[model samples]
Target: MWNHTEVTKKLSIKFPIIQAGMAGGITTPELVAAVSNAGGLGMLGAGYMTPEQLESDIQKIIKLTSKPFGVNLFVPENPVVIQEEIERANQLLEPIRQRLGIKKKSHLPQINTSVFDEQIQIVLKYEVPVCSFTFGIPPRETIHQLKKNGIVTIGTATTVKEAIMNEEAGMDMVVVQGSEAGGHRGSFAEPFDDSMIGTMALIPQVADHVSIPIIAAGGIMDGRGVFAALILGAEAVQMGTAFVTCVESGANELHKKAILNGTEEQTVITSAFSGKPARGLKNEFIVKMKEHEDSLPAYPIQNMLTQDIRSEAAKQKKSEWMSLWCGQNPRLSKHLHAAELIEMITNQIEEIINKFHLIKETERLI
Candidate 1:
């Protein structure tokens, strides 16, 4: 079997793997605690959450496991750079507003990035052991504070340039999220379309460029995939879609079923959910939204418009109307508790490594 090294140990995790903090409340305390209790790092997705909500979740996670779990923050990165998108979203949502039982059009909520300071304070107050960010490099002062407080920091990177920038920016590690990863694309580089590199190519390339350890995230699911990533020089592996389907996960039943039922081709990257690109199963909502691509507003605005509709759709088991995120190797998703799943994966990794050794021994005799 392949020798497991220190990833969580360096990061203070019991396992080398970390569960990606899927946003929009998909990452729950139980889900995180289960993983942490099982040895892997479980991260609370605090992207859209308010400070109070974030605190409550942190408390809940603490209740579940005293072992270290991380929290993911979405750094402010909006590409729209236009105020017209707000008006555009209202007009586009005119029909949705009518059906949502609202009589008059209401202006979109204040679009502001004022929450970062407050969010950071809460993390510091709680003294969280690990905090990771997406979108771009977090402030150097904040990075210094985290390091000073003995907190391990992680930055998500989609390209070599981003990885190098992260290393320079003083991040402790970089999550090399390939294009095939579920949910949002952590593209901090120009020309987002060109940032779609797969894990097999991106991991080694990023590892080679940066002196920091790389966490392979994207299509990794089973033990064979984990072993493959370790052999590629990845210090650890992070799996998002696979854990999203776990019994302990907070994903709605429809969303969970959608992930477990999905095939590689069933998923596609679309900005229909939010103005930003994310990978989800192609459904009626996406196909219909494609017809009005020009009218779609920028993120947060587009994200808010579909919020209620997505919620209602989930209650009705309408997976087509919701964002169903999954990775390319989603077929590896299994129906098991988070802890049991980890045990199974470890066993599989051992078996795969043993088979390789057996092959090598036979070849030597020949």
Candidate 2:
């Protein structure tokens, strides 16, 4: 069975599938519990949540299922430098804000301090089984604390160098996130442009060099992807886009619909929605914001500025204004229950392995 792999045994899951911790309410307790109950490691996206909110959500997940689940946090960076360029970027957004009938406000909202410290405390207090971090690896002291408390640590990497750093930092595993991943690019050591390694290419290389297990991510939409990743030396596969359409996912209806109707060409990597480069189904906001791309503020800041518009768009069911994140082959996604999808993917991988064995046996006699 697929659970015989090192990752499955280590994570105590029946399959090597990990539901990605896609933040901004997509990775709800319902979805996480559903995936965990289905034998895959469901991850809770705890980056945007406050310490109190995270504790409440974790308690809810415990009530829902006894299975182990992971929580992902965004590693905070140095303080963002404020400049007049941010003002210029706001000037650019004026037109679209007007179109949405949003009233102009006097002062810009205060930049939020990263809640990484507070969130991690909650994880340790609650004894979360696994914890993953994006944007960058956690400090050695933090990693030590988590490991001391019996938590499995995972760090996201976009390049082989980043993976090496993770291994050096004592990460239990590394999530090798390919460029085709939706939402945010987890690259931290280098610029986003230099870290566009695809899943197939990135996995084997990271696998070749790192002693720790590699969790392959990005553009993996089906069982074939899961099988391929394993063959490339990945211990498991992490999927986000595939689960977005699942009934248990917390993605808004319009966001789900946009993904369901989208073409591969419809999605583009843009920093418009958030300051960091992220892929999403392209819309009016992306197109209009392109001219001002040079002036946009850094992440958390840019993300804050656009929050109101995105919320209003979701409320109005306007696809053009909502952020619909998905992978390169989102059209391949199916509308199914979380358990049903997990079962289907498991079957496909099993069948593929069987067919491979049959082919190898036939070839030996030739």
Candidate 3:
């Protein structure tokens, strides 16, 4: 019989282990399929792809696994979308442009949730079971539409206040993203900074306040992290850095090798790559970003300026300039199949449960 937590029973997932959505190159169809088929929930990262590309990937994932999976989208915060950052970032990159062998962006760039309504519409049309949003919450209507189709909604938050807002916006669940998380910081207000709360502090408080289900994320790696989160009231745990090392992931060889070769001390938060604070591996680009934080444009501008550089770095195996996102617990990673990885976690969680019971039994005997 399947021992399902409330989350597992609700979603029909076997375990409460959810593969965190790593946008861009990490969360591929192969990775998502392997995870969901193995009895955990998997979410497809659709942040950087075109809608058609997203459709293709979703189809591929479905073909690979009959089990239910999900998709994640990034919601840009209000005010500036993509252009302000692009134009500003291009100007900032004038000096590096000469050396990078790329001409300056000739046209004035403008970016806003491109085909935003259409993408949400597609999510409904396809009847994807679960959809997650980050950076900011989607419009009220967007949330209502997804709910109407019975899509499970999750929002990411780095702080408790943001998690409250997610609940108010009617999210089915909220991912409590700690400071130690990789890739982008999911802060929705003010700016990203180390509020300094670890996963332990962040998870429980968010759980206490929100009526919706809470999913814990950050530096969680093994059974201990899973055990801790469950005790703290998280219905499930969302993990990213650990999955990046899995054989089923789409992370480049260099990227996977970097994670395998990393340490707790190797990770640092820098705004150089995207103009938003994010945890990643230490490299030359990261160093420069820290040194020139004041010089960079805001957000997507900084993100756009470095996009091509990151692309080239991936192609050439230049780990120094790439946005090699990672978490604090990366040193403990195992290079294994996605299915086997979840199984390892299951063994650990079961051991913890059994030991607790044994201790209780001894107490009764005494």
The candidate that wins on TM-score is 2
- Per-residue lDDT tens digits for candidate 3, residues 1-366, read 113567787788988888987887789899999999998898898876678878888888879988888888888633444555555556656655455565654553455567566567778877888899878899888898898889988898878889999999998888888888888867876456645468888988888888888888998888888768888888888999989999989998888899898988888988888777888899977775576776667776677668877776787677877888899987789999999999998888778877776443445678
Query: What are the RMSD figures for all models against the true structure?
Result: 3.3, 2.9, 3.3
Highest lDDT model number: 2
What's the lDDT for all of these models? Answer: 0.82, 0.88, 0.81
Q: Which segments of model 3 are wrong by more than 4 Å?
A: 1-3, 78-109, 357-366
TM-score of each: 0.92, 0.95, 0.91
Q: Give the Å error, residue 351, model 3.
A: 2.1
- Candidate 1 residues 121-213, lDDT tens each? 888988888899988888899999988998889999999999999999999899998888988878877567888999999989988899888
Model 2 TM: 0.95
TM-score ranking, best first? 2, 1, 3
The window of 10 residues in a row where model 1 has the poorest summed lDDT is 97-106
